[model samples]
Target: MKNVKWFAVDIDGTITLNGNGMVNLNALSKLRYLARLGYQVVFVTGRSSIEALALAIFGGTTQITIGENGGVISTAPNSHKILADIDKCRKGYEILRCELTHVNEKSVFPRMSEVVVDRTFNLDEGNRVFKEKGQDLILVDSNYAYHINETKINKGFGLDSLMKALDIGYDEIVSIGDSTTDIPMFNRTKYSITFESSTKEVRNTATRVVKGENGDGLINAIDWIMEQKSYCEII
Candidate 1:
């Protein structure tokens, strides 16, 4: 890979083969292979940083993880950098809970900087409520659940923070994902890959949309990149 030294990947729909959160071992293996090739693989996800860290540890990738969709970053086992105000997210959640009775909290790993709720209510209605109440919070659908995050934070912000911390440039990374939440990351990177299962907006945001879905799609993406003479000059 030319100047690319890092692979930033989303976990849920991007690597998980099934909707029930079953990981695709094949994709995990492919990530491991990339790691062996000196490409640091970082998990940038909406899932809890702890959970993503665990995946990184067990999957034999880099231990760094960006969690809560740009609100939190885990650099070590017991250390995390909080990027967003969880209090504001909590406040937004409370407002939504009070206004939308059907908006129930989803049972998820403990979050450090965001609130996650089940995808049972209309997101536009929630956005309208936030707009009317002047809350600086936004709801994002991760395809696995709904996340209430700071209006100013996103995966791109998180990745930028990580890049700065690691002394990596923006152009030194490649991003992969399957949802609109990953669009910010896509915009920040020169090479972004999404799958056919992603919505048109997400596909349009990516530099390329690969065939297949989930882990199979991830492998296909790696293969496609390997075939690109511009990106695979040294490899």
Candidate 2:
């Protein structure tokens, strides 16, 4: 309980297992449980900060979020700060839009720190095109979409920033996620949990692999953490 005080959870494939882009009540309840237990649950996700903020407000009193795979940080519902340079993001996106044939305007979300879009073409080809346009930017594919993001930016970077701002430590946070994008956070934390249904890379990266996937998996992880912490305290 003393060492682990925060949960940096992934959104799409981790918490909302259904891929419906909405956190189910079951997931929300466990988040509330964490809050009640004096734990801060900051969502570290591929979803935009606005989307993450909405989920935070709906879930519990946890008002902070790291969204767009560590591109934006939101302490409140309506306000947030982007981590990436706006000029670089703009230039890369503009170049990519001109170069990539499958850049779907309808599927694209506005640039925050990353340009997100649904998978329409070969992601490998897309990444190649993006790199050709802007060598500084990289394309990351998660459970749902493709993201044009800075090379150095990732979930771990976002979580690290959040920890510094809140005066939390790396060992004090439990990073829970189920995507390739979640790998860096896994390395950043001493404690990382993923689900059975995730990719082999993700499963292997995590310290603990839950028997279930998505919300059920997350809830199970939370219970396990509580038991582990309790045992640690007793000892």
In lDDT terms, how accurate is model 2? Answer: 0.80
User: Which one wins on TM-score?
Assistant: 1
Task: Name the lDDT of candidate 1.
Answer: 0.90
TM-score of each: 0.95, 0.92
RMSD per candidate (Å) reads 1.7, 1.8
lDDT of 2 by residue, 29-116 (tens): 9888889888888888887877777788877748898988898899975678788875675576677678766676335445578777
Write model 1 residue lDDT over 96-183, tens digit each, in one string: 9998969989999999999999999999999999999999989998878889999988999999888888888877888999888899
* TM-score, cand. 1: 0.95
How far does residue 22 in candidate 2 sit from its true spot (Å)? 3.5
